[model samples]
Structures are given as C-alpha cells and as structure tokens.
Target: MIAHNNMKSSPRLENEHEHENEPNNLIMKKLLSRCWEESRLLWRLAFPALLTELFQFSIGFVTTGFVGHLGEVELAAVSVVENILDSSAYGVLFGLGSALDTLSGQAVGAGRLERLGTYTQQSWIICSATAVALTPAFVFATPILKSFLHQPPHVSRVAGPYARWAIPRLFAHAMNIPLLMFFQAQSRVWAVTAISGAVLAAHVALTYLAVRRLGCGLRGAAVVGDISHWLIAAAQFAYMRGGCFPEAWKGFTVRSFSNLGAFVKLSLGSAVMIWLVVSIGYGSLEFWYYTTLLVLVGLLKHAKLQIDIMSVCLNYEFMTIMVALGFSTAAGIRVSNELGANRPKETKLAVVVAVSTSAFMGAIFMAFALIWRTSLPKFFSDSPKVIDGASRLGYLLAVTIFMSSIWPVLSGVAVGAGWQVPVAFINVGCYYLVGIPLGILFGFRLKHGALGIWMGMLTGTFLQMAILLAIIFRTKWEKQAELAKMRISEWGGKNENQPLIS
Candidate 1:
C-alpha cells in the first residue's frame, strides 16, 4: 500500500511540472510573433528609405566621377566645394528638417494628423529664411577658401564658380526637406523613393549631356544638379496637393504663420522641450566634422593629391553611410510614432530591428571595402597615385563604415526621444575636443598625413557610439511616452477650424 501511494504522488508531481511549462512556452511564442511583426514594419520603411538615400547621394557621386576625369584641378576644386561648403549647408538644413521627423511622427501616432501640414509649413518658412541667409556663403566661396582657409588658388577659382552655380539647390532643399519629413511621418516612403529614382535617372542623362557631350564643364554640372533638385521639390509639392493626405493635409493655411514668435522659441529653445534648433546644431556638428577633416587635409603638404585621395575615400564613405542613414531615418520615425502611440515595448522592438539591420548592411559594405580595396577607387579616379592612396586607407575606411552604421542609428533613437540637445553636446565633445585634437597630433606632429587624421576622427566616432549606447541602455521608455503625450496635447490644440488654401 505504501509503494502504490509513492507511484501515484510521482505522476501528480510530473503533471504539475508540465502545467507550469505551458504558460512559459506560450509567452515565448507570443514574443517571437511580435518581433516578426515589428521587423516587417521596420523594413517597409527602411528599404525604400535606403534606396532613396542611394539615389540622392549618387547625384554628387556621379558628378564627382565625371569631374574627376576632366582634370585633377577640377576634381580637387569640386571636392572642396561639395564636401566642405555644400556639406555645411546640407547639414544645418537637414538637421532643421529632423525636427519634423520627431514632431510629425509623434503627431501621427497620437492621431493628430492635422498638425503635420501646419508643422511642415512652419518648417518651410524657417528653412527658406535660413537658406537665403546661407546664399552669400556660396556666392563668395572663393574668397573664403583662399583668404580664410588658404586652399590652393586654382582649386579655389574652380570651386568658387561651382559654388555660385549650386546656390539654387539650396532653395530647392528648403522647399523639399519639409515635404520629406511630412511624408515619412505617414510612411509614404515609396512615393519619395519613386521620385528620387526618376529624378536620378533624369539627372544622370542631363549631367552626362551637360558635362561630357556638351563640353559645359563644372558650371554645366552645377546647373544640372540645381535643376534636378528643383524638379524633386516640385514633384513633392504636387503630390502633397493631390488630396492623398486629406486628413493630415487640409491645404496650406495662414495659421502656419500665426504664433510665429512661439514657434521660433520652440524651434530654437535651449530647454529639453526644444528639438528643432538642437537637431540643427547636431546636424551641423555631425556634418562639419567631416568638413573640418577636409580643411585639415587642405593644410597638409601635397594638398592637391591628398585632397583627391581623401575625397575618393570620403565619397565612398558618404555612399555607404547613406545606407545607415536610411535606417536612421526609419528608426526615428518608428520610435517617435510608437512613443506617441504609447507603445514603449513596440518602440524598443523597433530600435532592435533597425540597429540590427543597419549593422548587417554595414558589415556587407565593410567586407566589400576590404576585398575590393584596390579596385573601388578606380571608379572615382584615373590617377594612379590617388587610387593607390585611397586603397592604402581602405582598412580605416572599413572601420569607419562599420562605426557609422551603428552610431547614426543610435542618433536616430535619440532624436526620436527628443534628446538632440544632449547628443549635440556629445557630438561637440567627441568630434571637436577629442577627435580634432588627436587628429592634429597624428597628422602633423607624428607625420601620418590624411590617414592619421581619419583614424583620430574614427576614435571620436567610437567614443560617441559608446556614450550613445550607455544613454539608450538607461532610457525609460515609459517616461518618454508620457512626454510625447504631453507635447502633443500642448501643440495639437491650435487652428482646428482655420480655412486652409494651397
């Protein structure tokens, strides 16, 4: 009778164990299903964004390729203009536009779609003014290059003309950047990609005709680029007015100009609540970091050849980094939208998928850089020395690409959370204080040249990435969601009954 009782107890215990494991297995399955869904949404935004970036960056890339074969002086001159001057302008404008990524995305998540059109219009006002202010810089670029920076005279002369011709593109950006953010907030990414592809195809043919077949040289290339940008902006505007976004876009309104003082204050405020100006600052700092690198390269002996080699490497860097930026853009949209929707877990999952996908893309590019180090530079140049110098720096470029892949995604996360102010500070500390100083030491003091400068900058990037990781690790997503709700409530109460006219 005792033995029979023991056997019965063993079976009961085993059955109890099975019952406990079932809930755990169910939870695991649920989590996996959510992860799969999050990944699908992320790619829907990311893949189109990636292609758009590729096409956009290819505009300059193709121009550089064409200019390179013209002569070394033309190549060097265009490099300075495009890399330093154009980059500075693009950085600030892009940064300003980033504000909309956060605001409009959150607005959509909160179901306040009407706010997007107004926010976009306000952005257009500010960005247009800023673009106008930036014009004199491009117009007088030669003097600044020669007098302040002491670039070679021939390079300056060519670059000056090119800069002047590139001015229209700035205004075009002012019109288009707002539209891009407006569209991305609503996941209208495929439209943007299609426009980019069409513009790029047209641009390639026109640029080829103007620069090569027509013998129009740098001026023609610049003019063609300017036209391409205008075309893109016009196309976007046409789309916005086509009644697809009836809920979000009720046509343009005078309300976009009302409360101008408050809007400016919010855009440029130093407080944590402010995002636009801080995003701009971060954008400027991030882009000017590379521009500063180019300046340092200019100061070196054998400046022209160094510029050529560095330019090729930088162009490739730009191309690969754009892929990461696509991921960055999607991350920003996803995180902000999820936070607005009060889904912190979904936001967290979105971050994971975005970072992982971008990292994989970066790895693929890195391997390509390593394997085809010698062959890659030929696409940009015919000069043997330029090709060889670039190839020698290939390993450094690979590392930079990988680091770039990770950090931009992290920056996107910060932007989504409205943490641009702190990240802007981080950028200054890392890129300016640490990276620039170390670069000077390595490039001039220790005689490592352009390679050393890049390595030092790479160090700064690594530090920035690590610090961002720490910040993300400690972030309270629930609190962020609360803040998003608060922000939407404050801004979403205005101009509901206004008459909007396109």
Candidate 2:
C-alpha cells in the first residue's frame, strides 16, 4: 500500500509541475501566434508607406480647403482640374508604380539584390520618359477641359493657370512613385514616411502663405503642390544615394532601356486599370453635375456646398483607404516573402490573417460612419441641403468603406502572387463597364442624384469584393509558391550556384 501511494503521489507531483508551467507555455505560444498572424516583418516595412500616404493626402486636403475658401467658383475649378489630373496622368503613374512593388518584393524574397536595383532604375527611366512625353497635354489644358466637361467661363479661366502650375508636379510624381515603391519593396517605410511628413508640413505652410497671405489664389495652391512634389522627389533621391539601400543601388547601370519593352508590357495593364477606375468615377460625377437641376441659389448655396462637404467626407474616406493600403502592403510583402522562402502554410496563414483583420477594420469604420452620419456635414459646411445630402449618403459611404477594405487586401494578395494583370482586368470590368454606366443611368437619367450614383457604385464594389473573396478561397498557395520558385529560377538563375552576399 505504501509503494502504491508513493507511485500515485509521484505522478500527481509531475502533473502539478506541468500545470504550473502551463500558463507560461501558453503565453509563449500566444506571442508566437500573434507574431505570425500580424507579420511584424511586413508591418516594419509598411508603417512608413502608410505614413507617407497619410501625409500626402493631408496636405492635399489642406490645400483644397484653402482654395475652397477663395469662393465656390474657385473650389469648383480646382475640383475639375484635380479630377482630370487624377483620372489621367496621376492614374497612369500609380498604375505603373504597382510594378515596382511586384518586382522589388519578388526580388527581395528571392534574395536577388542586384535585380532589385535594376528594376528600380528601369522604373525611373520608364516613368520619366512617359512624363516628358506627356508634357504637351498640359499646354492644351483649356481645350481638354472644354472637351471633357461644361463649366462656367470663370471656372475655365482658372483651368489654364492651374494646369500650367501643376505641370512640374507630373515629373515629380513620376519620380516619387517609383522611389516610394522602392523603399516599400525593401521594407524601409519609416524613412519614406518621415521624409513625406516633413515635405507635407512645408507644403501646407507654403500653400497658406501663397493663397492666404500672398493672394495667389488657385495659382498659389497649384504652385505649392508642385514644389512639394519636387521636394519629396529630391529627398527620396538623396536618401537612395546615401547608401540607405546599398543592395538596390550597387553600381547603378543604364540597363533600363534594355527592359523597356517588358516594362511597358506590364505597365499597360496597370495603366488601363487605373484609367478605367478613375474615368468611371469622373464620368459619374460629371453626369450628375450636368444632369441634376436646381435653382441658382440652390446651385450656389446647396449643390456646390454639398459637393464641398462631400469632398471633406471623401477625404476622411481616402484616409481609410490609405489605412487599408497599409494592410494590403503588408500582405503583399508577407505573401511574396513566404512564397520565396518556400513556406506555403505560412503564406496561406498570412492571407487569412490579413483578410480577417481588414474585415474587422471595415466593421469598425462602418460603425463610426453610422454614428456620425448626421454630424459629419457640420465639419465642413452648415447648409441644410449639404447636411441632408451627407447624412443620407453616410450609410452608403459606410458600405463602401467595408467593401474597400476587402478589395485592397485582396488586391495585395493578387499583386504578391504576380497576378496583377487579371486583377486589373477585373477592376476595369467592374468599375468602368459596370459601375459607372449604371451610376449615370440611375443618378442622371432617373433623376435620383448622388444617392443613385452611390447605389450603382455599391453594386460594383460588392461584385468586386465577391470576386476577390472567391479567388482567395479557391487559391492553392502551395502550388502558387511552386510556380513562383520556377519563375525565379528562370529570371534570376540558380540560388545554390550563386554566391550569397551579406
């Protein structure tokens, strides 16, 4: 009996010891899981990119607000010019810039440092050439504005000055996009973010002085924007030369021209994607403005005022989009890295975590929009019609926010997987072919105004979300990783035969 009791007690003691360590073990496991799920590695790369975007948008808002104070006519003119630039030139730049993310991320993942540098140089050359080739368009800005939309004579008068002042920004933007993407690809987001923030501060100060104090009006706003872009480009170039990206800058060669054909081939898809999405949006707005009828007082006091308020609301919405970009960027890096590293399970988990987190964030944004639906307009304007328009559209915006969250994250996954072409096609089909046309039909033809336009947009967004979700669910990460490895081998040569560099 004594022997049996001793044996039982020994086992019990062992169990007690395990129980004591169980909590500690659990804690360690939790930390590891969180690290894997959140992918701190990727966030370390994306945080700066996020900050850069935030600063850029914030400066834009401040400049727009300052111009709005000049009078509704000025605001309308600025808006029209901005819409054109966004839909045309800026869209093209951003679309091509996406190539940087894909190329650099994949090269980094495969540990091909030299190739990464080559890609960056090529990107700069291609974007710069495109910018230079496109300069003549700005000189004929008035004609282009007239061709696109009908506006007041005063509004048309401001277009020429705005476009001329904004011309230099195009080159700045061309350089900025690739440089920003280079840092993002290499996981140096913080540097980009810090530099961007400084530039934005300078921009706001200059804009205020030029517009408010110097009385330059819309021209001042345009000039400030151009200066900011140049500053940002210079800072980014300086950083690149300062050995911040030694791997990507080693022996800068003029190898860009050799890759021009391939670059254009890939960029065409991105360009079309951007053009379609932005054109759809611009077309919808134009249709509504032209078709909707209101009294002169209503047009001045209510219609125009509502647009200004919506612009502010849209600024907030754009911020949310930037935040979503953060998650998507992280997703892109994580997916590419894991695929390159031959870790299929981790890649799958990364996508799952990214999408889930984005969905939750969307829910939070929706709640916030819902709660602030009525009070939001007061932040920008006080007109009852403006307030009413905002309040009614708030719910629509919430839904959009949710859809946007899912859309961007999925886009990141596709980009990381080297599937940009197909994704771009999807965007074109949904946004331009389906969404905008329906928006015009409902908003203008049916006389439902902005609400009708939003509903049509919602339809497109939901369809996009569904398509992305389906792709995510059905994709086999392991197979994709295998294919990626084959592509890397074809492009960068054998890893085992090549000497590894520190």
lDDT of 2 by residue, 56-86 (tens): 7666667766887676667656765564453
Displacement of the residue 434 alpha carbon in candidate 2, Å: 2.2
TM-scores, all candidates, are 0.95, 0.83
lDDT of 2 at 62: 73
Report the CA-based lDDT of candidate 1 relative to the real structure. Answer: 0.86
C-alpha RMSD values across all candidates = 2.8, 5.9
Q: What C-alpha lDDT do the candidate models reach, one value each?
A: 0.86, 0.69
Q: Which candidate is the best by TM-score?
A: 1
Clashing pairs in 1: none
Q: Clashing pairs in model 2?
A: 48-189
